[model samples]
Target: MGYTYPVRHQTGTLTTEQLHLLLKNPRLIARQVASLTNEKFLADYLLSGRYDAAGGGVYYETETGDLYTGTDPEAIEPAGDYPLIQLDEGVPSAARTVKFGQGSVITDEKISREGNQYVQKALMRVGNQMVRYVDTVAWGVIASRVSSTSAATSDGVGAWTTAGNVLGHLMTVREARAELATGLDLDTVVLPSAKWAKLVGMLVDDGALPREQGNIALSGTAPVSAFGMTWLTSPHITGTDPWLFDTAQLGGMADEKLLSEEFAAAGQTGVEASTTRISDNDSYLVRGRRVTVPIVTEPQAGVKLTGTGL
Candidate 1:
């Protein structure tokens, strides 16, 4: 005779049946937390260009002293030798591209007890951290390359906080930048959040037009276009100084990989993600990574205004 084991039926203990029912009907509470917005990232607006390779280089042409001199054709006799105009290649430069990332781990036991909530939250947090890191790096690159500096009060104009010719001061800087041979139109201005607040407040209090005051009032901390330039504010810009530059010519970012989650079907180029299982720990490791570098190709294209405020 063959040995046989008894088969279990659905008629289990009352407590076990109730537990199964509860598990099948879970109460809906709320949706996952919203992700952060990218509005505060200056890199998105300042840096330009993209590269697919791991590491690359940039070149800036050296400005000649006679760049502004007229080179119009002059009348010459037949067969007379014409003046020779010389041209040269740009100066080559390179910036280091390094990987940056953040990671989080989810244990199997947690998933078995709860669900995939932990994993989803972990990924969101990791992505946010990557964005912050990139912005910090970009700011550092900009601060380092901008060697030319000036004081906002240099022309006897009081700081922006006081009653002075704020618009005139900005125009003066813009004009100075235009005077450079390699300069582009200074269309962008970056200020710390506090300084920006002070500027708007002063303008509004100083009898600004009703329409302008209303616009400023409604645009709480968002970038506003005024004084013929786009004004941007960021908490990451710790100093009281401001930066004026042409975004197109200031610099660029070498983005080798884009930020993406593991198992995501669509993404290309700065940060990426990977998942791995740790057998010993009985957990899954999720990691986010990015490969990029911020480079200032034309240092002269940007000007840093120091002592802009009291």
Candidate 2:
């Protein structure tokens, strides 16, 4: 078989600095997805754990003291320390890479009529897709863990269309946390868009009152504060089971950071765009990968509000 000479060889023309600049788009994509994934849920509140350490794993010890008693009138015997419950969880790694051909690299039109910009968008899209994939995996892990054990169900009053019902459901979660000896910190609440739409209407009472009183309204995508915890919504999550958990104990862990790489086809040459590669046909190939794992160290730290209806 004989090989034909390509129409353009742009990759060889890119400087090291230019390549690095091209790589920045993938990073931006990663950041955007991170905001939508577990990072947003965990960073501000949950325990980071020890997953960041090389050869990832998290270790924790549970210890308690026993009450001391003695029959002697003035002397009391010392009580021995309770046995420690040591716990450890290994973090698993995940990876992905997406590749596109040359036809997409040179021929497709991007924002600025520049071929390189089109490749940048393509690579960034790969990064975004990777984030969504990992996010779903992480949440699946959480859901599985919750399924293994019983989650505190909501009172069958109704959906959160009323203030009383919303508070009642959250209170039930607080009680469940206490039953597990977990403190009532209630750090975060995540609900599906369906449930969140119902919750936002509950910010203020509809009761008619005189004009002098100031009414508070929540705006934008900011987290809502109720039942002494922050509340948020995720489009990725489905169903009406709202997750109420103490982020200090239950959250996500990563075994590795986001990874990115670009390779030029063999025997290919010319100016390569920032996030592009010259294929055998003189087009570009875009590729990316991400490594992560989901962790739920303490099941009792999370509570899911089960739904009966809307």
Candidate 3:
């Protein structure tokens, strides 16, 4: 309870200085940081260090588990103004950025002092923000070339390919950084494979969309809806499609009917890629300066979830 929640921008186009200010904002700072419970936890434990009692007393156990309570905290994530790669802005008279360490912890006031210390240290701790500006001409030139996107920004359809997969990515923010952090100038985004995995995990963990079943496929524009939230073409979505689901999945609430009524083979198959093609719409990791996250509170709790045939 005494610990602080250190919010950070994992990797965004946002600059270091701007991120600090964003964290200090009235809204962001005002957002309450509470000691919540992650009822359904996804985690791992590690022993940071341990010392045994030489006197034959009880051996002190330093076992630590990284538990994802699955209860994602609500944060008023930061945002930045202007473009990330606006070199035409003359690379500015000077530039800056901030780096922050990210992680979380649980608290147990009713427990012993040692447990409290663990909770205190583990509580949402923020790291020092490292600031960096374009130092070299090449870096500056490329930064200028992109002209307002994030370093990770790239080009693609800017649309969803599959319904379940797409929605899953929208759920959890992550242990590292908020995708839409302050200070990003996302006119030019470069999607990385690591980020894609994160995006996919965010969706799956949230239950908005289940994990990839087998071979992924796209339906012929069926009126797809999840949890009766909205209507969009279900199955697989492509960047070429004009419609962009608000906050991803056709609806914030995934349709329960599909899992109960629909056929097993509705979406795209998890086919291995054979074509050595590098096309924007081919679904490779593209840059993403920032993503538009909508206000969809209250994630729908589903039935006794069990799975097989992995």
Candidate 4:
């Protein structure tokens, strides 16, 4: 009879490849939000990405395109008038930093997990925060600066409750657009969910065809096209006030340069997994500094449908 010796072997050192496999994949909530808002529209008017840490602020400039009135009725070239230029000052907001940690034990337990759910949530929070800021900037531009009063004033509280009022507001937005000498052909309006619902109901009561009511037959989120403008909904805005602005005439700015790293100290991660970690459940940091100023280059390009409960 032969006696067999029982042997067991274990490696204390973790390999780079093995460690990566055990790493949890993180979610990209920030990226998702960016896709929905920032990347989709807000970044278009970026005045500057380079925030001079020493300069303290950035300047945004806007000027109307050349004004050629009838190309000189005398059949001779008239003096070319320079565009009217305006400069806006913008200061970067404080950078938003969020930190999260994956403990050593949890790392192993979650190694088999599909992705970094925790990181995803964190990025989402950061993304949402940035978007909200953007929304704030945009809302301010429209509510405070853009002139809706010229064409229309507040309908009074609960004024948008009626179909006629809704249509009236839409007409004023068009009037606002027409006021621009070289107006951007604005074709979009943003409404709150409640306002959209009310608008749809009113349209239905008016006996308008589905297409006339924005043809919302197929999807609730489907954009409605009426009064020469496509109406969209945004949860960020108030139900009583809708934002009517020109997509062609909006401006936004963001520092696309994302500075991110994981702690090796956590390993690679990002608004994505750029901060994905490797160390014993180490922590990671994602930092983004954004200085955004939504400029109503053409104030006539936007209108705020007011008359709501303050």
Candidate 5:
């Protein structure tokens, strides 16, 4: 015999079966919101990859000796023995994955009055808030690791507001890149939204025409490339200065489980969701969560600009 769902006679009063069915569309909407919000997060760009493990520490290599020393075998004499070099095995470092989540309650009264629109809005808000919370956590880890302690003070270029020497700043970034180990370059620069606007305005005033200028003018927040470095802006990074780093070598994200098995099965990897019906409250509780941690493997791979005067 087929299972029978409870019938609803009163208008706007959803049955148990109808409530679960209504959750489907709202859940999809929530996931969509999360996908859009994820694009604006700097953590996804700064952190290169994901480390999957239930529990334990992660290890990463540290640069010690010159990696570009001798490439040609002909350089070594046939009789001479090859020089033995010791590699620095990375130390074990671990960060416990913390759960970030947000809950939204869909009461029958509200659903009865507001219908599916209310449910969609509530669940979408939950998704955005949960993802934003996780993003803040990831950025917190990155900020703590890539601090301004040893940052380079902007020389020649004064505050960006006064049409500061943009080329001069690029030169400084080039010099910083030259100082890094072989095969590593500071190809990414992150700026605050306000500072990025100043940068765009400065460029426009200077009559400097970049390929991305059109898009920048249209959106006022698009990432642009200059001097072989991708310049990005994020609301999460609030400061007058900028951060330059090698995205490939800096760090990564480690997650015990990005999503529950059910969510993974549904192809939603970063955020997980759960639903529960509250008997006493006559409502359904929907929650979204993320379990992850950002790990800065190479602190030296990036630097925060200290006295940019922006």
Candidate 6:
């Protein structure tokens, strides 16, 4: 699950728990088990409309309002490096429920009466990543010397009027969180300041940051001082990681390599059919007991920091 290097100079610095966390990456795999344990429990077992449904059954994002048309409102923008978002104030609590029998066999006449309470109550305790998902950000800046417009004149550095002039920027925490999901899709991103306390509050209010494992860090502009919480740096799964091996996180997903026609008998429906394919439903599965997988940690748990002058 990991590769470790022994630093001769640093001997037994980390505590027992910290050392374990540093060494192991917790892995989760969800199989296609039609039971209470499978991730389907999250999507299927819950009362319909309870857990957050995968948007479009493909990409995951809460900003259904930002749907694209000919223009594709969420078009990519160019930046010097990775663009950043200012943490917004707060977000409203939006609950998504999973009604038991949307497409399933459970009919209104059958368990609707008794199961209704069970599903709602179950949904309350176990929520989906989408429920806690955050994806919203807006950009703004204050001009030095109080310039009405943003412009760069022919000078060494874009300078304002004098020493008294100053400029600052701010982004809503919600917006900052959303940018992490949509823009810089990361597994676990580190922040400059100590923002865990703030992030923990947001999670307490908004829900977990669309992830069971992995970390998003936020300290201060410097290493010593802290900011609040890097809760906003976390990112969502965009297009699937094509090369990742199939596992439990994928709902009882069968290994794609084994499913291919080459792996299968010679005769296949088509060329792609000849190749291996992952099931859409089981991809990114939840961890469970009845269905077990090798405990794997998030891919980018100790993600290296990118961008200059963080």
- Cα RMSD to native, each candidate? 14.0, 12.1, 28.8, 13.6, 8.7, 22.8
Alpha-carbon local distance difference test for all models:
0.59, 0.45, 0.21, 0.44, 0.61, 0.21
Residue 9 in candidate 1, Cα distance off native in Å: 49
Model 4 per-residue lDDT tens digits across residues 122-169: 444554565555555556555665655422344322355555666676
- The positional error of residue 308 in candidate 5, measured at the CA in angstroms, is 2.3
Q: Select the stronger candidate by lDDT from 1 and 6.
A: 1
What TM-score do all the candidates reach, one by one? 0.70, 0.59, 0.15, 0.57, 0.76, 0.16
- Residues 44-88, candidate 2, lDDT per residue (tens digit)? 233334353234333333212111121223433587454444333
Question: In model 2, what lDDT does residue 161 have?
Answer: 58
lDDT for each residue of candidate 3 in 152-199, tens digit (9 for 90 to 100)? 112221223344423322222111122433211111111223433443
With candidate 5 superimposed using the best TM-score fit, by how many Å does residue 10's alpha carbon deviate from the native? 32
Return whichever of 2 and 3 wins on lDDT. 2
Q: How many backbone clashes does candidate 4 have?
A: 24
Query: Distance (Å) between predicted and true CA of 33, model 5?
Result: 5.5
Q: TM-score: which candidate is best?
A: 5
RMSD of 1: 14.0
Model with the higher TM-score, candidate 2 or 3: 2
Name the lDDT value of residue 180 in candidate 5: 55
Off by over 4 Å in 5: 1-38, 56-86, 147-154, 161-164, 211-214, 258-269
> What is the descending TM-score order?
5, 1, 2, 4, 6, 3
- lDDT (Cα, tens digit) per residue for candidate 5, span 114-136: 77567666755775565467667
The TM-score, computed over Cα atoms with residue i paired to residue i, of candidate 6 is 0.16
Shift in Å, residue 282, candidate 1: 4.9
